[model samples]
Target: MSTRLIIMRHANSRPESDTGLDHDRPLNEQGLAEASQMSQALIDRDWMPDTALISSSKRTQETFALMMDVPCEIRPEIYLAGLDTLLPIATGIEEGKTTLMLGHNPGCEMLIATLCGTYHPISTATCALFTKDGPHWVLESVLRPEALDRFKRVPYEVE
Candidate 1:
């Protein structure tokens, strides 16, 4: 059995708005639309998550709320968590299950690099798919909001 993981960074947030605190920052209009679009793309690909683990930040929570139809667990530790904190949560996932994680940057991007052995720039609302085979995690694909436009005309395949 293969364990699939979809890791996504929270969508575009209103950093400039007077939220007064980073954790309280909410998703902007673009973020909401982007999350909805990503959700549709996942549905089209039949990749809807069975379970999700989300950071407790408002932006992450709001992003997950827009994109999910399954049960989700909020982990407060994931807010700006480092690779050490993120990897264990990922590796502990049982086989034969698909898990999605909505998290913040640096940690999310670093965790992806640690798992798949390459560092890729992770923009807001970017999702990376990986398949775990035994102890190794293999990169399956990555989806971004900007690519959605092209995907409508032609399927995007990661090389």
Candidate 2:
């Protein structure tokens, strides 16, 4: 059976905080605001995931937390990950009715570009939605923060 994947970049964060704890950085003000807005859009658009996987980073963890009732798994390899580190996760996923993969970029953008045939730097909180057709997931549509605000339909919601 096809397993859908929704890849989301962690919200804005203080990457330059004096705290050297890369895994402890919290979302900045804008990040929290964006997360609030996106959370609503996701709810309105019915984009909730049954299962969520995240990089074992602070920012990613916070992003996963904003969502409701999503069981989360932490993956260290996903931190500052590249496509290779992400491909296996996408291909190996099983048992989740719908899956949310939250992590950093360029890995997050790179993975979606490789699988979806699109390219962008993936601004914080951007998400690329993919649907599993047969044995592989296909790019159904893309949504950024601006689009989410405008169109809260499913992943295929048009501009």
Candidate 3:
């Protein structure tokens, strides 16, 4: 049995000038649009998640609301968490299920890099895909900076 982890960063945000609340900041126009595209990309790649774990941050919540859905639940630890916070969170996951975790920067990116043994430049609105093929969740391929970059790069020949 294998567990698939698709980790995604929230989409773009409006400048602070445009919003009053950082904690409740909703997605900007560009962010929403990008998230919609990301939703389609997920469907295209057949990377649909069976269950989702998300940061309690508004951005992560909205990203899931706008992009994809597979019975999402909120997890406060992911909000502004460090690398140390990730593996513990991952350990709780059951084997053989596909899980999507919508989280903040550095932590998610750092985990993907560490597990996949490569640099994964996770950008806003980007997703990093990894899998565990054993009873314990193990490292697999790292598809970093997904949805937008991978979808668009092939057409423009941007590697």
Best by lDDT: 1
CA lDDT of each prediction against the hidden true structure: 0.87, 0.77, 0.72
lDDT (Cα, tens digit) per residue for candidate 1, span 1-159: 468999899999997647598999999999998899888878777778889999999999999989877999999999999999999999887689889988999999999999989887888888888898778998888888878863481333556
Question: Per-residue alpha-carbon lDDT of model 3 for 35-91, expressed as tens digits?
Answer: 887777677667788899999878888889997657988999888788899877766
Q: Which candidate is the best by TM-score?
A: 1
Residue runs of model 3 more than 4 Å from their true location after superposition: 17-21, 135-159
Query: In angstroms, how far off is 124's CA in candidate 1?
Result: 0.9
Q: Which window of ten consecutive residues has the lowest lDDT sum in model 1?
A: 150-159
Candidate 2 vs candidate 3: the TM-score winner is 2
All-Cα superposition RMSD per candidate: 1.8, 2.7, 3.7
Q: Estimate each model's TM-score.
A: 0.93, 0.86, 0.81
What are the per-residue Cα lDDT tens digits for candidate 2 across 90-150?
8777744778889988898889888866675678887777888776667766666655554
For residue 47, give model 2's deviation from the true position in Å: 1.8
Better of 1 and 2 by lDDT: 1
Could you tell me the lDDT of residue 128 within candidate 1? Answer: 88
True-vs-predicted CA distance for residue 62, candidate 2, Å: 1.1
